[model samples]
Target: MKKRWIVLDGSNIMHWKGNGADLATVREVTRRLGEMGYVPCVVFDANAGYKLNNRYQDDAELAKRLGLPSARVLVVAKGTIADEIILSAARDQNARIVTNDRFRDWADQHPEVEEEGHLVRGGYRSGRLWLNLPDEAP
Candidate 1:
């Protein structure tokens, strides 16, 4: 079976704990997404490391933490946000984005996000992960 490509909003997902940035949460999400048969590519803002570890985290380091190759983990340039990169990656890959954001701000620019199942939203409930995605990956 061919695995579909999918994008993850690392900057947003790292904060899933509601306390501070958590790399474990990101890893868990990545693992679950992969188990669902999607190739998960994560994009993070420049300061993700600082928020999570109070230090800089390059793509290689983050990728190692997520058990993915550096190429699949992108840390955008300083002052650059990850939203556009994440959305663009999803568009280019023709894959859905796993994020809680509706991308309403970019609705005019990224109209594809409005399509059904374009964004796979999910979160941890009592330590269990649940994603609202189609049973079959496209």
Candidate 2:
């Protein structure tokens, strides 16, 4: 059987303000995803590494703290587009995107996200992380 994968929009999620975007929030999200049997792969904007300079040694360290393998966490190269890279990776793996972004700009690349179950959204409720997938609708 094919393994289920969840592609995370790291940049968008990390900036989710008070929602499911902080370091602890992301860790919780990953834990939930793992419990559900989905492999969570995260992709971040290249600048994410630089922004964390004060917090950790480098992006690798940050990823490690998040319980993510270097191979599973990708930092796009400078001048590259994070959204495009994320979309490409998700398309290649046939994974569902876990983000709050509407991705209006990348509609051409992911027209199917408008369809049910193609995109997954994350939210916090009662101090707990919750995942909402279009597929979960009855």
Candidate 3:
């Protein structure tokens, strides 16, 4: 069996619903990743905790409810660039990125992204989330 490691761009998917990135979308993506036989590790930008706050909950409260394990989610430090972090992790682990972001700014840093299978891009469509992976063609 092949190992399928996926590095998810957490902030991007949280905002995929048009309102904001939320726990629901994150869970949905996680579930789908598992169903597809992929092991996922989600990465978030600094201050991602703050952005989760809505009318009913704060960061800590939401975190408790979210119950994500430490190993599964990673948050970059303040002032650090998330793209670099995401790219580095993917490269080291030989994983693909799961995000709609084109990462055009980091083309020089991650040249492999331009090649097929380096990035898994997708978005919401017709009330459902859709991800596009590279085709298995030589």
Q: Which lDDT tens digits does candidate 3 get at residues 1-138?
A: 987888888878888888875878877877777778888878777777778763334334433454545676777777888889889899988999988888989999789889786888776778887777643211
lDDT of 1 at 129: 70
* lDDT (10s digit) by residue, model 1, range 1-138: 766998999888887767788989899989988887889999999999999889999999999988999999999999886888988999888989888889999889999988989988887678777778886432
What TM-score does each of the candidates earn? 0.93, 0.84, 0.83
Greater-TM-score candidate between 1 and 3: 1
Q: Candidate 3: misplaced stretches above 4 Å?
A: 54-68, 134-138
lDDT of candidate model 3 versus the reference: 0.76
Residue ranges of candidate 1 with Cα displaced over 4 Å: 136-138
lDDT of 2 by residue, 1-138 (tens): 678988888777775556433565666767778778889888878777555443323447657968988778877777899889888888899888888887889888689678766678877666556688543421
Error of model 2, residue 125, in angstroms:
1.7
Each model's C-alpha lDDT? 0.88, 0.74, 0.76
Q: Could you tell me the TM-score of candidate 1?
A: 0.93
lDDT of 2 at 33: 82
Winner by TM-score between candidate 2 and candidate 1: 1
Every model: Cα RMSD to truth: 2.3, 2.8, 3.8
Worst 10 residues of 1 by lDDT: 129-138
Clashing residue pairs, candidate 1? none
Best by TM-score: 1
